[model samples]
Target: MKGIQHQLDLAFGENAVTVSRKAIDAGEQNLVLTANTRGAALKVFDGGATETGASKLFGGNLTASVSASVSNTSKAGTDAIHNTLDTNTKLTDLTDVDGNKLGLTAGNVINISGTQNGNAFSASITVKDNSSVSDIMNAMRNLDAFKGATVALDASNGKFVVKGANGQDKDISNLNFNAQKSSTDTTAVASFNKMFGGFTETQKAQDASSDNSLSMQIGANQGQTLAVDINDMGTKALRIQDVDVSTAKGAQSAISVINNAIESVSAERSKLGAYQNRLEHTINNLGTSSENLTASESRIRDVDMAKEMMEFQKNNILSQAAQAMLAQANQQPQGVLQLLR
Candidate 1:
């Protein structure tokens, strides 16, 4: 219930709608919602998603849902590909199945061709030294087809193995190998086949589970969004929906389940708190910008009454001085007229 309210506030602005849980009876509680404004309306739909704010608030469904869970089905992965060459023996001294040493020298190329992770690729591994199986395994890892796949030696089987990364499904197919003849070694292809041709698949590949996460736009602009992966908080998800607490053992089990539910809820609350803090900071920055812009607008549009009044008084004084000078000149002209008479 708190999750719903937090999502609402995050969607419709803070405090737009308040949701409160109140006890109606001894064992029942009612969820009460009070809208502080008339614009807040939550519309519940039947299908997948809608453009309404309510659809996004509820994670594009009728109810707030948990993240898409990975199917607990058996993990699908690629068959382990390995070579029969003894891991303890060096490539130069490695013996064939006939118990004869290969006597391979440097510059012998082991042509590896396979499709890893659905991409077809081929490469030649130049024998750096007959040192260890890692020379070949490491070289295989550098291939683009095996970019994210694993290539290692299986100690239990003494065979070099390759698998998908993190147990995910890897499409490895059309695997083949050949040895190219070099000037230093004419029998390189025959020696390479005798030592490395025993590669086989120990396991088959399978697919991974699907994800059920929903993407929600929290901000007004593009890319200002987050993926909401709410864990199912209902009794079924908490493992307490069908649990009976009538017996002592049942009650004990219920305690454990409830504790787990509390932890889950606490984790969700922590995420909500972080999101709220971030939104609050964004709102504060926007508010500060609004205040600064308003102050600038006032400075441009508002009049300075004191400054204007001072300019008016100075202009009035200049006009009076000019009138006084004109009056003095007129008096002098009148006196000259009297002298002429």
Candidate 2:
């Protein structure tokens, strides 16, 4: 949404219209684009095509329910998409979806297999007596499969979520977890399926709305434009929107969520800053090119006074020599007539 608004501001003046997200009900999320004044139909010229502000902001043809406020212009999501796992969970002292603690002891090995971003992933995590919930999350995060994904516990429910690091929907599937006894373990361990298998995808992964993304002209030539994809920056997108700070354990779980959100925002800001720098460099290069072109045009069209003066001097000297020779030839003709007389 910020990205959309930025492009709109570049196309139109800043604050010509206001774009915002509103919740009509618990199940749906929508965007609202309102003109500051009546009869101000917000619009923008993207590349060669002219697009209405609503379509550019929401992507594609919008079936908006218009009112005095211009509410529900587009659907962002029904709710933030995420996969949830129990909170304050440790491998050594495992708790299932229910309140029952399992007989999982130290040295129990949990194996995980999943498809992340359309790639197969497998990893085994060893449980230690001192390992906390964070350890498990770290293990998942460290896996190559979850490189562009975030694994963090929810602050409110102590349940963790796995989501796109950039607050976008990710393709992840067949995430299976099961436990076995380690080489040194002798005691009969509780079934890992009851605990780990209960990990549910609470929300479905929804792709970000690309149709709303407008390609802005950033360079002079054709196709020198940028289409900035607007990623969701909501807490639900980060899987930390429902965090609870009322209890100590909840607060502890919330720590990872808060940190993850902070890190995500920081990374996003860095990316935008880098983009700004690239634009600045492009402007400088364009300016330099314009200056060089002007110099070339002057050389082609402008006259050189010094060279013209030198040519004039050379022509005058040659004309003077020719006249002197003509005068001497006339004298020779007169001398020949006097001899004949």
Candidate 3:
């Protein structure tokens, strides 16, 4: 009986069903309803009661605290060079003591070369015999290399000025200007070299900087909170957990930190929403698959009465034809008996 009970327990309780109960009577021992109730507790526990309870524990609202000591460092960027020509300079003044135009001859070339952000470029302007300074300046302005820089006459100072473009703090120390006369006009080379000697640097490069900071909080659990600090989101560990934003420096730092945190949280929420949608789709697909599989099983197991009846009629007709053929064969044997007589 013990062996039989063991086999029954294995076959019915653990294998064929989620649980099973058995009753046995022994001398002086009555199991009574003990076995029946024994499996009940196991069933309840195994039916996800503990799991459901745990899930409910986390269903409460999440809580979070944010403290930040964000300090946005303001490092200034250096400005590029701004230069002005001598106020009394004139294009026609480029002449030698002989009263002849120096490098200002037709076909004379003026070269402007400079570097911006480590990029080097050179532009050339061919002088027209009687072109004025304005015409020469216009030609230089049209060069691709000079497009990013400004070239204009400072009317207030009566000086020609060349400066870095607006908002660009480019270094201009490497910028240079030179003039070369046509080979035939060798007398003007020295005069052309002296023309650019009048340029004076008016402004030195200076750098600019800005600072920012902020503080915020996010929920982690019901009545519980996780602290977050927002620092430069571009930094490693992309979180600001312990920053203090009460002081001026802290407040400045918190600005960028808070902005980054907001972006991070928004992205996380978007990811969670995407995951939730994916899970819902997965559940729907599973349900549809289960339904389709169930239908297939039903079709495989179920009998079609109309088709079965047709098959039965076909077999019955075949049986009748076989019986008639057997009877005809037996009659032929009897006819042989008659001939023998």
Candidate 4:
């Protein structure tokens, strides 16, 4: 017979491809397809900032001092023209009619008389009728009393008036008037101008007083005062304006510096946020890759139980057939023995 049972055993071993059984015996490791990924958790500021190449951290706030002050003072101004007064000045030894010797009281209203040529001239004056002022006023108009002179009221004061025509001095030393002790010596003209100069000097001094106050002091601070001589009247500042650097520039600079600092911080905060986003994306990518790799590995290394079962059934059928063939071959040897019997 073409079939040889023992030869089958010699050629094909008892179990070939038994690796399938070993694989089936080894159970599947993929009960679950678990995937995981992780990257560095996002940090606010650290090595990542350097790696990202961000802007340099800029600091804020600056202040500068400015010290300043100014001063103005009253300097010597133009000298104004002035008038002066003389207190010890008067005509002495003059008189009125009473047969009294010639004399004048402190404010005696005596007639002012000027002697021109050999006759006396009287100055126009206003005084009490009985007073010397009346006597001086009337003599000015009467030719007999004031021979060649006219009188004017001294506009500066109303007490007594004196003037001369042709700007000539009156000769009062030989003054000639009837009211005088003798009329022969009363209206002297050339002597009057000499006496009047003394009185004019005093009037000049009083006018000067009105033009200026000699000295004044102005306040700089509380207790501080500036001494000034006011020849010409005007207003002036004792203390000039000044700047306080500590308060003026410092306060405003502080605000500007603070604002710059705030802006810097805000910019840094924004950079940190960007870094966080990158980290999150990294974590997500790693997680997806790890999941895919795990799934591929599971498929490649898992067991197939249905294919193993089919192979096992075929082996069983082949094994049963081989046993029957082996019995038939041993029976042929038995037939040879039966013939010998």
Candidate 5:
């Protein structure tokens, strides 16, 4: 409604801003209104005491129904478009119990998968080149994501550079690029570079596409999380031993925990959907009502430019005739002078 009003202000004026604040003033207004309780809606003014100004909403009600008020004539403009178009995120992000993120990679990746011991969690990721060393260090430093995993470089000989100092057996899934940045640019990289649309580099850089990856490992049992192995470049898979639960019930219990967590997340999403629906319905009704009211107002108050133009033209002719008559009047006075002469 704000958006519509804004547009109307831009096109017409703030008198276009429609607000429905139909409240029954407690003592200020009174008139015997026809009992028309149709559709839980009470349109058709009852002339009932001028409504004392729209009824108030109860404590639990969200927003009270009000009539559109053309409060300001200059306040409508295009800036209110955003009010009509709302983008809301209703769901919580998908994360592990400890909130570990598995995100898209910019360039090629060499991943390492592994399991955990008593306190030490280990995994190794392979990088396409030594350029990944800094990236590896950075990921390791970010303990907030992979809370249980401590990352370091394993001894490298010639062809193989090892990661995962704690000895967690992790599989390697490396993302491969076609040769250069233009071949495979990702959003993460583009954001730093500000590629408006897709991954297309404005500047050219050689060897930018060369693959670089960092192997990583996290907790042994950070709860049952489904592992998604990312593989694009030449990479190998690393597997972990199945969790050893002594009894079937123990395993089922873990599964149940995972299920419950998933369900909770789903419930939150459902709530968001409901909220969005309710808002959308309200906005829809408001928009329709505003439009109808605005059209009606234009009919009532707005001067038709075309009609005004015609009126002005007629008045212009009359003025011209009046000027001619005044000249004739002056000639009559001259006649009096002639008689005196």
Candidate 6:
């Protein structure tokens, strides 16, 4: 009976050893699954083919918005000037409407005065004895202050119209014309003053504008995004959306627009590249942390094969010794029965 009991104890010990081995196997399997999951996450971050679809963890879309560069346009502040003299009328031959001998002379001067960006400036043109109406117009056009301004002859209505250039609205507003003559020639100075008497308040200038923006998502967390006004890159900002590039003027405008767009795109790209670099560093850090954690888990859950084998040997030897002792005890019981007989 003792021998049988020892055999039953040995059977139970063997069963426990088998259960422990199975538990270790399950732990190793779980570790493998964990490793695989971490690898998949890394792949998603890096962007690659996966079982479900291509990874887009860090992939971002770029949008460029642009507003056209506007040229300021303004009308003249004063009414048109009606020329009383014929186109060929010489400066010395000019007279007032009342047939009075207006002492118009070659030494008469016309001054254009204005403020450009708050800086005061003045330009003058001297009249020659042979100067005609056309010659006077030419001289006005050549003046430094009026060089960029548009001067047109309205022959049908006998009027002169002057318009401020695209970007000279401030200067146009402060524009004033004065006629200077000899102290004794009051009539000539008066007549010259009447020629440009209409100038008063300059027309208001219109500024350029744009409505372009780029909304971007930068991270997985909520509210992790950046919205930038990419106004300088779009068709409207570049002034090409409505421009007709078929004409020389339109083509020149288009060139300017393209250059602006290129600059905008380059700046945006630089910003995005910086974000990419940061994300790459984050990925490297995550990978390192995961590796270290996995190693720690392995140490805790993984079985030491050599040590376990040594334990198994020790248990087996003890079980065998118990069985032998039980056998010896049974034989002694038999000897006791002989003593009883």
Task: Please list the C-alpha lDDT of all candidates, in the order they appear.
Answer: 0.54, 0.57, 0.45, 0.32, 0.33, 0.48
Which regions of candidate 4 deviate over 4 angstroms? 1-251, 303-327, 338-341
Task: List candidate 3 segments past 4 Å from native.
Answer: 1-103, 155-158, 183-188, 197-341
Model 3 lDDT vs. the true structure? Answer: 0.45
TM-score: which candidate is best? 2
Instruction: Provide the lowest-lDDT 10-residue window in model 4.
Output: 56-65
User: Candidate 1 at residue 27, lDDT?
Assistant: 71
Runs of candidate 6 with Cα error greater than 4 angstroms are 1-87, 166-171, 182-188, 194-198, 201-203, 206-341
Per-candidate TM equals 0.32, 0.33, 0.29, 0.23, 0.24, 0.31
> What value of lDDT does candidate 6 attain over all alpha carbons?
0.48
Pick out the ten consecutive residues of candidate 3 with the lowest summed lDDT.
Answer: 73-82
lDDT of 1 by residue, 1-341 (tens): 56766775654334545566566678755455554432324432223333222221101122122111121111111121122444555766665322445555666777777765556777766665655566667667887766676666655445445665544556677656556556455454665564445443322343211232444455668666555456677765554454455766556535645666688789988987887787778788778888999998887655566678789999999999999999998999899999999
Q: What is the Cα root-mean-square deviation between model 4 and the actual structure?
A: 65.1
Per-residue CA lDDT of candidate 6, range 43-76, in tens?
Answer: 1111121122211111111111111112211111
The Cα error of candidate 5 at residue 188, in Å, is: 45
**Candidate 2 lDDT tens digits, 96-174:** 3222355567778777777766778878777788766687777788887576666777654344567654445566777
* Native-to-model Cα distance after best TM-score fit, residue 161 in candidate 5, in Å: 54
Q: Could you tell me which residue pairs clash in candidate 1?
A: 68-212, 76-206, 77-205, 77-206, 78-205, 79-203
RMSD of each: 24.2, 21.9, 37.9, 65.1, 35.3, 43.0
Question: Could you tell me how far off, in angstroms, the CA of residue 92 lies in candidate 4 after the best superposition?
Answer: 99
Model 3: per-residue Cα lDDT over 271-297, one tens digit each: 667656765665786688889999988
Query: For candidate 5, lDDT tens digit of each residue in 130-206?
Result: 33334544443353323333333222210122233233333322211111132334223222122111222111111
Q: What TM-score quantifies how close candidate 6 is to the native fold? A: 0.31
TM-score of candidate 1 to 2 decimals: 0.32
Write the candidate numbers in order of decreasing lDDT. 2, 1, 6, 3, 5, 4
